[model samples]
Target chain A: MDINILLVDDEADFVETMVKRFGIRKMPIDSAKSGQEALTSLAAKDYDVIILDVRMPGMDGLETLKLIRARAPLTEVIMLTGHASLEAGMQGMNMGAYDYVLKPADFDDLLDKVRKAFERKQLNAKARKQGA
Target chain B: MPRPANRAPEPASDPHGDPKGILARATGARLWKDHSLLLWAHFLVPPVLAALVVAATFATPILAGILAAIVLGIAAVSARGLLSRLSQTEEARLALNTQLIQSQKLAAIGELSAGIAHEINNPIAIIAQEAEWAAHLIGEAEKGCSADFAEVKDSLREVRAQVDRCKNITHKLLDFARKREPVLQDVDVVRIIEDMARLVDKEASYKNVTLVRSLPQDLPKLRTDAPLLRQVVLNLMTNALHAVDTGGRIEVSALADDEALEICIKDNGCGIAPENIDKIFNPFFTTKPPGQGTGLGLSMCHTLVDGMKGKISVASKPGQGAAFTVRLPRRV
Candidate 1:
């Protein structure tokens, strides 16, 4: 099954590269420049996983995560950061982000985490359906 | 032996039915061993005294009357003793029941607040969006006409700031409510503690507080979730930093034994008040001035530690500083 994915980051170059990389892997992905834009995209579509950057221009990644979780609980989020801030990492994990990845993240590792997150989302959806 | 017609047959003959028999035998043996003297006294004393009273009554009336009075006195004393013991047991049970109810109540409150926080998030988001939109419209109007809308802009700013604060509280509430199942991996616990300590080092220095690390080089690696442990350790260290006074000292130490790994954060500052110590880990139980603290930090730490299958505890005296310890199993 195709895993609908969204990447949210403020850095234009980083988002561009990520989009191209995923495209090369035959997995087309959507991108958003900021938390506000991410929320707008989320409102329109159901994404299985989101690659969110911790540091954003307007609303930071942690704040964005809270809203995303509230809106789409089944959607898993993986936090991306340029610097290793322990504080941010703690907050991201506590806020229910699927995982935290440091910048200069290895492509293979990121792919592995994305696949894992997508699997969790699928399981969550199945569980909810069964519960209902 | 023939059983009575109204009596049920016994299961004691079946070998597989020996469980109940064994339990009964064990309990009977224990009772005999612990209270043999009392049991013997209860059976023998009453009849022996009755015989003696019968003999004395036949021989002399005064002797029989004195013996009967002594027996009555003994009975009264024993009855009082039994009554007091029964009340003590009742009191103990009541205390236990109260403790159980208190914990259950806290759990319910935690769940309710989480639900409320989740429901409140949507409205708070709309309010924030409307505030932002209003500010945007005001800016556009100013561009078209020469007008100073500084007061209006300031009010909008305050509105946005307040919304952000509300967002913070709700987000924390959601976090506290989040049920994170730990994904176990081999983790270097000492490294996690050191990393978190580094995060708090600059803040500690700014307050002239000394942050000490006493992690041993040979401490064993733990099998647990890394991020959750890191969150717990960092939160505790931050709390210790906040507790200490200027030029005070905070110590972060780790040690391991056969079964569990223990990390302690000790602070030498104004100690916890005796009355507030128990409530410190309760959500929304903060001593800080209004709007200064959400009081979720320690409680969140408590929840996280519990999720990791660890124990978190505090030892404090009113004037003698406080120490917080987290104990995690070597393999979890």
Candidate 2:
């Protein structure tokens, strides 16, 4: 699968590490350190999946997801957070996020979610193309 | 992270028009029900007796005088004792209520700290994983007989060790917030100090500060919580870093005597002020600007050390830097 993923978080070290790890796996991945940067990256290129952190300085994950869906409805978003708040998770889902994952998440689980989200995105794109 | 943007305005939903009016109305009702007769008699009795005395003085002077004295004596003594005792009891209840409020506040703070710890753990995990990956790469490079292999290996080891320290900090913060009991074990202060020195070496150099270690070879292992002890040392080291500027020096030394082990962190930077010395270990007391410090570092250190039956002290003056010494009992 040709998966283009965008990882958004405030932690630079985490972004660098994940970028390197994804690179080693031969995946095309990009990183943004804040929500504004993430939105800019989203506008510039088409991504199959976005892994976004919920808590950020400005333009939180939920807000960014809202704008992304409006701008590029085909893109799938998987929310990530260190602290687990059920209300936040539910609100993110309500706001059209594909799924929510907690921090220090098992690599296998996160990869599973990302792959599923990408597959869903591809399906939606194909459906839209057929409709056109 | 961010302060509350806007507070929602409260609504006026009181059934009663005003709180004070409601209180007064309730008090008035109770007063009328409980003591209306006594209150009315209190005012009427003296005047009625005086009128009786004046009228009876013309008839029987002895009877009127005795009646007046008895009524005055009973009114004076009865209410005085009851009022004083009631006020004393109220005062005691108020003090107990204040104490209850304080404990509740502490409990709330504990829960907040736990939430913060969870947030911090994610970044620590990332840093740790990155360090691990770097270590793997370094191990591979070492196989190629690289000239800089030794230095790279040492630096990677330091990074990994410090990441572990960061992990411990998050764990300890959660445990402390949950009020969990510490797990005691034999901890070597020498090794702890060495790891901490390595951890802060990069930061120290970045600020052009000299880092020194002075652990003697003959120190004994101390019994305590390893992570908590590491946290204390880490907090002290980080504080020392902020206390100094360029060309400043920090020395970490450990010594063991017959009964206890002493680890001292000395710095040649800006020392704490005399007034702040006493409040240095207080929660939320910080000299650094908002967002720079949580102000919990030293207070948490103080709590952990005290939990281990240890003592931590500081000695310093303005412009002369400070030294923090932690004394823990030595274990065989």
Candidate 3:
């Protein structure tokens, strides 16, 4: 029931609104204002899921996913997009985002995708430990 | 607004460059420059030759007459040749001009369609949704009256169909003008037609243009891009729709013949001028206002038809409106 999550997005309103929504749903969460802040958070702490938005100005979603995969290879990042752009979604997937959701998104789908990502990350961790 | 009587500047200066200019010039030029010189040369040359051939013939009076006859024959042949050359040159120029105009129209249509699709997409969706809600309320209220429900359903379907038609027409207009390959497939004509109808249904409705269709029982299919054919049908129907006045009827029908299937869109709008009839298929010719029409619709249709080894023709009378015929080779 306890799921640690990092939400990184430049749109303060969207980030705050989603934070409130997740709080109501009782999901453990940390919020970051930018990609660098998200990286710093990951370095300092651990999270099960990272929800990122695609169209951030300087450090966009794809770049964030790249850095996240490099730094926290085990953690899963889900891309949240504003417009349903086919190109951005494919790029996000290619860059190793767990799953992509369109904005004004279905919260249930977001939850389902995050839950699967968490389960996958756990399996990956166990596999690494056994290999070690 | 009063129509400007002299919008074209006395119709001269560029008189040498209308689509009909070459033909007019060849036939209408004041005098043949070479004719006078040739006439004088003929009179002089024949006498010298005749004198050389026969001193007796030269002395006879018919030599001068013979030379004059020869000059007349030459002029007739030269005039014939000039007329033929003028027509050919005009046709060639027209073909080039058509391609240019068609390309421009396609570009403009694409830009407009994409913009309209994005801008009006929300409103169209909302209108459709609101229309749905009204339809629903009617259904609910009239459940007790079976006849009322039946009538309501029928009318709502009409409204729904109309909305979708506008959507299709606009989308088709846009895509036709965009001129991209747009990924072809073995598209079902029914769906494409419905899509186009929906796009333009709103426009048609506002214009008081009634759309009536007679699709074939089982029309032949084609291996073509959906977007492209949608463009072709869209252009024809939109043109026909615009031509017709409010309360006028537009008959859009699709049929099949040997190795070919066709769509003929007929409108009860003001028809083409007899002089402009043939020129309509040429480039940059439109009955619509300058900004309203790029005059590429028919040309694009021709280019598309030609590409498919198909053909398009128009039948019209001055006051009776026009019918556009589109025939495409049936794909096996």
Candidate 4:
């Protein structure tokens, strides 16, 4: 399966830049502006992993994480936060997030985290198939 | 504003300065005695001075000079005693102010705890869902599947949930730590004051300070930030009640005069010293001793009132009682 991923954030320039970077590397990337939109995309498409931003105007990242866990348990979520509060990072980890990477994120670090989250999702899917 | 619950240092039972806790308790009695002594000496001295003058006029100069020395000695002794008594009164006032500071700090911590509870609740729900999903998914997996993946999922989810709970509570505790924000707002004075009084009433029930509202029903609203205004009202009312003996009364009233809305909270407490009337609103200035006050309540109030593009003034004469008047711009 092509490794599918969703990058959700409100910053247009940041999103476009990341999309271009991913495109150059031929990495699969889909993006959304808010938590609600991210959820809608997940419902229609089966992404292996998701990258979510915590602080947004509406339906913040934490709330989005809860909805995602409830509706699409198999998809792993990697949190992206511009504000580096240890408490937020800790909470993200506690909510079964693959990991929360801080911004201005080292693109290489995010890619590494994204790869790990995809592998975790793949493992879960394989287990589910075998169990079924 | 919410305050951190745990950050409130426990009732500093052994406050650094004094563990014995007795300073100027007999201030009134001492002052009365000093004044009585002064009166007696004044009465006795006048008669003696008259006798000395008469003696001098009648050619008994030596007798008159001896009388003059005695009168001067009496005046010096009484003056020293009065000054000492006054200093003691000043020290006692300082202690009461300290107690007020401690109370404000504890209040701040309680506010923080409430905010922390709100922050933690969501992550806990997510953690639970993730664990349940992992559990059932693993249960349905192949009998010979890699147990390592299963172990990682279970351990990580458990670790994450516990950490999230702690972080949520701590973050809230920090966020809600209430302190004086020098920011002012255009507030609806009548509404804000009433809201504050209502909160104080619920809390005052435990202290038994009877809260009386004497507000003009149709007074124009004032321009003030609701949150800061609410806090200033709360601190003053709470401070008044603390000084008021149980079964004492606190009156909260609002009125308007031309361009300003005037709100007053009057309490029949221990009252304030004439010297202290100016110091009460100074930061860290309190009449209540350590562990009871942070000395910031009135200071915070003073700052809030001033920042609102208005004025806050207090009127009191020791023993007659104290009244705080706050004026804010009338909302159009």
Go through the candidates in order and give the C-alpha RMSD of each one to the true structure: 12.6, 21.0, 20.2, 19.9
lDDT of 4 by residue, B1-332 (tens): 33343344434442323433334342444344446876687568766776776777577778767777766776677677757767777776676567546445444434444455556655766766776776667666735675556565668667667766555444433433433222323345665566456546645677677999987778765545544565567667777777788778899998888867887989887789988875776655777776455465576566456445456778887765789988776642
For model 2, how big is the CA root-mean-square deviation?
Answer: 21.0
- Tens-digit lDDT track of model 2 for B218-241: 787777665466667767888898
Q: How would you encode candidate 1's per-residue C-alpha lDDT over A24-108 as one tens digit per residue?
A: 9999999999999999999999999999999998899988998998899889899898876766876776667777677877888
**Candidate 3 error regions (>4 Å):** A1-132, B1-184
Once superposed on the true structure, which residue ranges of model 1 sit more than 4 Å away at CA?
Answer: A1-90, A96-132, B1-99, B140-147, B330-332
lDDT of each: 0.79, 0.72, 0.67, 0.67
Please name the candidate that would achieve the greatest lDDT relative to the true structure: 1
Candidate scoring better on DockQ of 2 and 3: 3
Q: Fraction of native Cα contacts kept in each candidate?
A: 0.16, 0.00, 0.00, 0.00
- Give me the candidate number with maximum TM-score: 1
Show model 4 residue runs off by greater than 4 Å.
A1-132, B1-186
DockQ winner among the candidates?
1
Q: Which whole-number lDDT from 0 to 100 does residue B257 have in model 2? A: 82
